[model samples]
Target: MAYETVIVEIDEGIATITLNRPEVLNALNSQVFIELGEAAEELSGDESVRVVIITGGDKVFAAGADIKQMASATAVDVSTNVRPSLRTFNFIENMHKPVIAAIAGYALGGGCELTLVADVRIAADNAQLGLPEIKLGILPGGGGTQRLPRLIGAAKAKELIYSGDFISAEEALRIGLVNKVVPADQLLIEAKKMAQKFAARGAVAIQMAKTCINEGLQMDLDRGLQYEHKCFSLLFATEDQKEGMKAFLEKRKPNFQGR
Candidate 1:
């Protein structure tokens, strides 16, 4: 599908989705959210794309939600707005393949929420991440409340929200908020490298692992372990597992087809 707010490009088992609204700091409007969902739907269905990297254009990853739109919106708009954005986020998190957020400049409010949805986040040295929605007289409408504490712990998350402070990429890495930090100019290159690494792995195993991790997190230990075991057992039935084992014994790299 053709996208206006975003650009989706696929190559070598990876899909790069760049938020293209640099003029507005790649702000999340309802239309942007809709386009994000449409792009994710297509990427999720394309077997050639084993991994996805979400980034922003120009100097900012995203300055957050479109402030003008949000300021003019009503309660109904607020309620309706979150649904599409969260749906888009969940689409990335719940996809069989991994999604990586390559953040630079600003990743505030809704944009920060978008970063949290990815399975992995890699930010540039200058990236500024925060949940500043409270400053706007509103809380984060996306998954901020739920995902932030989980990413950076309750105390730190609370500090950021209550104070509306932005942390640099270095601090984010120290707190385990982001997986890696790269030079400002190399953010996309580094993000693509991570995507390629994920693409080379056993796709089915990785997908099941992601499922187990996501679903099991909401359950008790015993139930979660059982789900993990089920996922492990299920993988034995896939052609990739057979090929993986054969490739192992043959002393050669496994070429996973994502079958």
Candidate 2:
């Protein structure tokens, strides 16, 4: 499907969503959010695509939610819009297939929130990340409140959100907010490499692992253990698991049919 705010390209089991609004620093307008949801759904449904990358073109990953649109939205209106954005963003995180956030330039406010949802994030060395929602007398309406703490712990998330200050990629990595930092020119190169590497793995096992961790996060300690065991048991029933083991013993790469 075509999108006005972003471009989608799929090849070699990798799907890329390019934020197309370089003119506006790839700001997250309502249209962008809707299109983002559509793009994510498409990537998830396509069996040929094993990995997905969300990124901005050249200038910026995103400057965050379009303030122009935010400026005109009332509290109720804002709530309605933010809900879908949050859902789509979280959907990306929860996707069975791994999603990579390839961030360059500025990833601020909603932009940074969007990146926070990815299974892995690779940022340009000079890229800037911050949650400056407090600067607008608001908080990170997206999953920033929930995901940030999970990614970087409570105190660090608080400091970044409370201060609303931009931190360099090095700082973000040190705080455990991102997986790796690369040169700006190598951002997409490295992200695609990682995505393809993940795509080459056993899809079912990868998906199950993601589910186990996500479900465990919300459950109590005792329940989390039960949930993890359930996830572990479910894997034994899948063909991919059997293939994975066979391939390991045979010293060959497993061919996962995503069963």
Candidate 3:
């Protein structure tokens, strides 16, 4: 589908969603979130797409949310205007396939929160990331307070959010905010490489694994293990699981049909 604030491209089982508002440094807005949710919903039903990547142009992933759209808003506007955008973020997080964030330049405030939704994040060496909403007399309205602490530690997440300070890509990597940091020009390439790796795996198993990990982490250890075991047992009913094991025993590559 054609989108005004974003671009969607699907190739070799990978769907790339590029935020495309270069004039404002690809800032997130209500329209962008709506488009993103639409794109994600489309990809979710596409059997050909096994992995997804969310990115921006080389100069910026996204500067932040569109302040112009929010500056004159009242408390009522927050619920009417902003809550739907948060729902989009939730959709991205709950997507069936894995999502990777290919970040380059400034990924601040809502931009940083967007990355937190991804399963993996690859950033360019020149990237600067943070939730700087506190400077605007607001907090992150897009799952940052929840997801950031889960990625890094609570203390680190609190410090960054409270200070509204942007961290370098290297610093982000050290703190476990990003999975990898590559040269600026290689960001997309690396992201695609990772996406391709995921695409080659057993689709059903990968989905189950992602579900087990994501959902399990929020539960107690014993309950989490029971949930993992249930998901593990459920995979035995899938063709991909049998094919994967058979191919492993035969020393040959398995062809997963995503069944």
Q: How far is candidate 1 from the true structure (C-alpha RMSD, Å)?
A: 1.0
Off by over 4 Å in 1: none
Writing each residue's lDDT as its tens digit, candidate 2 over 1-259 gives 8888999999889999999988889989878888899889988999999999999965689998888888878989987888779778878889888989999989999899999888899999879999999999989988888889988999999999999999999999999989999998988999999998998888988998889888888889999989888889999999999999999999998888889
Q: Least accurate stretch of 10 residues (summed lDDT) in model 3?
A: 78-87
Clashing pairs in 1: none
Candidate 1 residue lDDT tens string, 1-259 = 8889999999988999999998889998989999998998999998888999999953799989998887787888778777888888888889888999999999999999999999999999999999998888888778888888887899988888888899999999999899999999998999989898888899899999999999998899999999999989999899899989999999999877777
Q: 1 or 3, which is superior by lDDT?
A: 3
TM-score of candidate 1 relative to the true fold? 0.97
Q: Number of the top candidate by lDDT?
A: 3
lDDT of each: 0.90, 0.90, 0.93
- lDDT (Cα, 0-100) at 37 in candidate 3: 92
Model 3 alpha-carbon drift over 4 Å, by segment: none
lDDT of 1: 0.90
Model 3 over residues 210-255: C-alpha lDDT tens digits?
Answer: 8998999799999999999999999999999899999999999999
Clashing pairs in 3: none
Per-prediction TM-score, please? 0.97, 0.96, 0.99
Please report how far candidate 1 places residue 11 from its true position, in Å.
1.1
